[model samples]
Each structure stands twice: as structure tokens, then as C-alpha cells.
Target: MNILHFFFGVCGNATALFLFLAPTVTFKRILKNKSTQQFSGIPYVMTLLNCLLSCWYGLPFVSPNNILVATINGTGAAIETVYVLMFLMFAPRREKVKIGGLFVFVLAVFSAVVLISLLALHGHPRKLFCGFAATIFSIIMYGSPLSIMRMVIKTKSVEYMPFLLSLFVFLCGTSWFIYGLIGRDPFVAVPNGFGCGLGALQLILYFIYYDKNKKTTDDNAIEMGPEKNPHQAQDQAQAQVKRSDKGSQNGRV
Candidate 1:
């Protein structure tokens, strides 16, 4: 292999490893808070869908040359499916429904399109269709991180956005981009380019909000405990509830 191929392969391998490790933070949160509220399965669901689609796309390339790609993406699909299943078992009813819907949608629409096109097309046409479809799907998958980034900026809290996860995404995006370039696959490289940019933005937002909230939380600790003054806390909460109700009424009016 040439230097370019070696570099891209190493980078892609590293990025995939990072993707594999991204879930550690979620497990840590589950252990730390003893609650699953901090965990969201949407990202994992989307990732699993992406992996499965890639695996399906790589099926036509059974030239002994693309087996590595198929194996990695197939493993990713299985692992992601396991993660989603675990989340479904543990998550709230509402979240479980959402994940289920996403799973069905991906399985139905995406699988059908790829299957139909693969069977319908022939020879070089098959390669072209699969490559094109994979490229589009990859771009959409890479864009999934934007929602988390938006949530972080809106809340000004990285509570739902783990720094390590974002860092891995950044690394993953970079590695895949290089992999695509080396493999001469425009479908992979183009999307990962945008993915790398978004990943960096998420990491920067993490640092900005992490320290900003730390001081506020520490400052609040010195004040009266909502736990110690239950009545006061209840009244305060009720007042906020009333205020919210009034705001909603006014909006309706």
C-alpha cells in the first residue's frame, strides 16, 4: 500500500475506534446519576441505521477488496443495534416509542430503496447507484450531531452533551474524511468534511458552557436548599407552574 492509503487506513481505524468508545460517557452518566434521563438513544439509533445502510451498500462490492469495509460497518450496525435495544429496555415509554419509530422507518424506507435499486440495476449501474445512495445517507448521518450541538447552545449546558463524545466524533469525522479521500470515494469524503466541521463546533461549545455552569451551580449550593425547605420549594415550584400556565394562556389568546 502507498503512504496515502496507509495514513488514511490508520486514521479511519482510529476514528472508528473513537466511535466505538463514544458510548462510555453515556454509561458513566447512567452510573453516576443512577438515572437514564441523561441518556438519549436517538443518536445511537441514527448511527445504527447509518451503519446498516453502509453495510447493505457495500454488499454489491463483493470483490474481495471491499470486504474490510463491509466487516467494519456490519459490526458497527450490530453494536449500535444492541445499544438501541438496551436503551429501549431501560428508557421511558415516550423515548422507547420514538426510538422504535426511528428504527422502523430506517428499516422500511432505507432497506427497501437499497434492495430495490440493487436488484433493479445491473453491472456498473449497480455500483453507481449504491455509491450515490451511500453518499447521501452518509451526509445525513453525519448531520445528526447538529441537533445535540443545538441543544447544548440553547441550554448553555453540556449536561446532555458529553465532551468525550464530541471529541470522538471530531476524530471520527476526520478519519473517515481521509479514508474516503484515499479510497477515492466522494460519497464518504464529502459528508465527513462537513461532519468534522460540526464536531469541532460541538467541542468548542462544550468548553464554553461547561465552565460557565460550574460556577453558577457552585454558587447556588451556598444558598438555601430546596430539600431543607420543602414548603418553600413547593410554593416556589407552584408559582413557576402558575406563571407558565398564564404564559401559555396568554399565547393561546
Candidate 2:
């Protein structure tokens, strides 16, 4: 492996770890309130899936010399699992059923990938298949912020989109993208390239609305209603982040 690739890979690992842990503050609040309130469990659930697929894709037998990808994603999988489990523990019954069902679906898909790759595929074919899975999910991981992005636009507030997380997303994605470029691995490069662009866009959106958000910060602090449909509640929760404001986290991996 090229030393520079290794260096960037390490950088990616560090930043990715931060990305995984960023939700701790939000999870802390769920614990404190003894309820998930309006928080949606989907991001954590989906992140768990991305981490699983990425980890598998990075294994030596699957892709070779990508241990850094495996290490960080494996750790992320553990962290996200805890967050999802915690969300389940505190979320309302209806919310529990929804997230639980998604969790099962994630497991089923992951199992299918593993079984098909190990049993039916080999060599470059296995690598390609695993890489395809990782890439698709990684792209989905970046796209997870769509709901939050919409909320930022509609409310004219960047309150839910923390500047620091956006910053880290850019930094981490850039590092991984570079690592993938140097290593000649499109699987890692393509999705992170997408992430880098989205991260940049998010930062731009935050700045564009920051001043406006300040003027209506009080009004924008809309409380969740019990009658909110699951979709609406999840939408609000998607815009639920910006941990710098004391832990109101929402989208992204």
C-alpha cells in the first residue's frame, strides 16, 4: 500500500470515528428524558447498515489491504447498534415497531450480501460485489441528510445542522476520497466523493441561512406534537441535530 494512501486512510478512520460518536450527545438526551420524544431512529439504523457493508467490503478476503476501512466501520457498526438499541428502548411503541422493522430489514439485506459473496462469488467478482454494496450504502449514508436539509430550508434555520458536524463530514469524506484515489479503488472513492460534495453543499446552506435563523431562532424551536404522523415525526427528527447547541442531533452517518 502507498504510504500516502495509508496516511489518508488513517485520517479517514479518525474522522469517521468522530462521525459515529457525534450522536452520543443526542442519545444522552434520550436517556435523560427517558423517552425518544420526536427523535427518529432511521439514521442510526441506516448508518449501522452502511458500517456493516463497508466493513465487510474492506476485509482482506473481500477487498484486500483495506483494513482501515474495516476497523473504523466495524467500530461505527458497534456504536450505531448501541444508539439504535437505545432509541428502541426509549422510543414510543409505534416508533419502536417501525425502527425495529427497519432494523430487521437491514439485517436481512446484510445477510444476503454476505451469503451471496462468500458462497457464490470469488476473487475479483467477490470484491466487485462487496464494493458495489459498500458504495451504494455509502452513497445512501450521505443522502440520509435530505430530510434535515429540507427542514433547514423550510424553517430558514441552520439550528439543526451543526456547523462542526458539517465540517467533519467534509474533512472525513475528502480524506477517504483521496485515499481511494491513491489506492485506485473506485468503491471507496466514488461514494466519498459524493459525500464531499454534499458536505460542501450543506455548509453552504448553513451559512446562507445562519443569519436568518438567528432572527427567528425562538420561533423555529417548534415542539413536537403527539399527533404527528410517523413520517412527519421522522422528518422533524431528521432535522434534530446540531449537538453544539447541547445535543439536538438529526441526520447523516
Candidate 3:
């Protein structure tokens, strides 16, 4: 085996580990609230779809001697499916609709892109075209967290974001980039450049919000129920306090 291959493979494996751990924050939120209202299922659903696509794309190269990509992406699809199902179980009706719409959109667009590319190109050209399209989608998918990043900056609190997950995303991106470079997979490597950039920004924002000396602030506080009733505000405040306490505890450890 080539030394460079070994090195890149190692890096890829390490980064994959990071990606796996990136959902801890989401899981913790579920555990803390016994619900999934604040979290969105679109990302995980998209991730599963992406994994499935990767597995499908790798089928031709899935010999016993070269099944790494197939195996990893196939496993990814399975894991993400479980996560999405769990999310659906606890999500609100509106959120569920959002996820469902996103799922359909992803399926439609992904299918169309694959079909068009397959029909329009062949050999190395097909690979490049597919890779380019995949990179564009991956960049958009990974950049989906920017809104949350902005929320963090606005609130000066990492309440909705978590540090470890951000770190994992960054590491995952770096790993995939190395893996792509080593395997000569431009499609895989190119999108990860954007993923790494977004992930790093997320990490930076986390530190800015959650650092030891940084004070917590809530800028966009909104009322949850009827505003006319003074008692409603009190009740909402009490419930929010409970949720915030649990969320903070869950986040800290």
C-alpha cells in the first residue's frame, strides 16, 4: 500500500469519528426536554439522503478490495435514518411538515441531478460533473447551521448550539478533505472545503458565546402564550426557567 494512502485513510477515519460525535448536542437536547421542538430534522434527513446517494454512487466500486466508501456511507444512511425517525417522533406538526418537505425536495433534486448527469456525460466527465454537483449540495447542507451561528452571536449564548458538535463538524470536514485528496475523489474533497470553513466558524462562535468569562444574554426573547394575561406570562416564565435549567445542565455535562 502507498504511504500517502495510509495517511489519508487514517485522517479520514479520524474525521468520520468526529462526524459521528457531532450529534451529541442534538441528542442531549432531546434527553433534556424529552422532546425535539427546538431542533430541526432537515439536517439529519439530508445527511441520510446524502449517505444513501454516496452508497449508490459507490456501488460500482464496491468490490471486496474497495468497499470502504460504500460501507461507511451505507452505515451513515442507516444511522441518519434512525436519527430522523427519532426526530419525527418528538417534533411539532409544523416542524414535521418542514422535514417532510425537505425530504421530498432532496429526493427530487438528487434524483434529477443524478439522472441528468448520467445522461449528459460519460467516463471522467461524468465523474467530474457528479462531483461538482455533490460539492454544491454538500456546501449548502453544511452551511445550514449559519442561522444558528448568527443566533449564537446575537444572544451571546450557545444555548442552541454546542461546542463539541461544532468541533466534530470541523474535524469531520478536515478528515473528508484528506480522504478525498488521498483517494483522488474531487467530489468528496471539494465540498469539504466549504464544510470545514462553516464548521470552523461555528466553533469560533461557540467559544465566543460560551467562554468562561463571557456573560450570557438573551436578545430575542419572545412570549410563548397569550400576552394579555399577566398570569400567562408568569406561567410561561416558570416553564421556561425549568426548560432553561434542564437545558443548561444537559449542556454542561
Q: Which candidate's lDDT is highest?
A: 2
Which ten residues in a row are the worst by lDDT in model 2?
219-228
lDDT of each: 0.63, 0.81, 0.62
Which lDDT tens digits does candidate 3 get at residues 1-253? 3566556555655666456445655565676787774445667777766676665455552211224555666777777777777777777788888877877776787688678756776665665555565566667667766766655565456655556556767887777776677667767777777778887987778766675754332322111111112334345445766897999999999
Worst 10 residues of 3 by lDDT: 219-228
| lDDT for each residue of candidate 1 in 1-253, tens digit (9 for 90 to 100) | 4577557656666666557545654555555665456346666777776777666666745222344456667887887787777777777788789888988887886677677766787666766666676667767767765655555565555544556556777887787777677777676678778878877887788778885525323221111001113334335445655897899999999
Q: Is candidate 1 or candidate 2 better by lDDT?
A: 2
Model 2 agreement with the true structure over 160-207: per-residue lDDT tens digits: 567777788888999999999998999999999999998898889978
* TM-scores for the candidates: 0.70, 0.84, 0.68
The Cα error of candidate 1 at residue 144, in Å, is: 2.4
Give me the candidate number with maximum TM-score.
Answer: 2
What C-alpha lDDT, on a 0 to 100 scale, does residue 167 get in candidate 1?
A: 76
Off by over 4 Å in 2: 212-253
Clashes of 3: 0
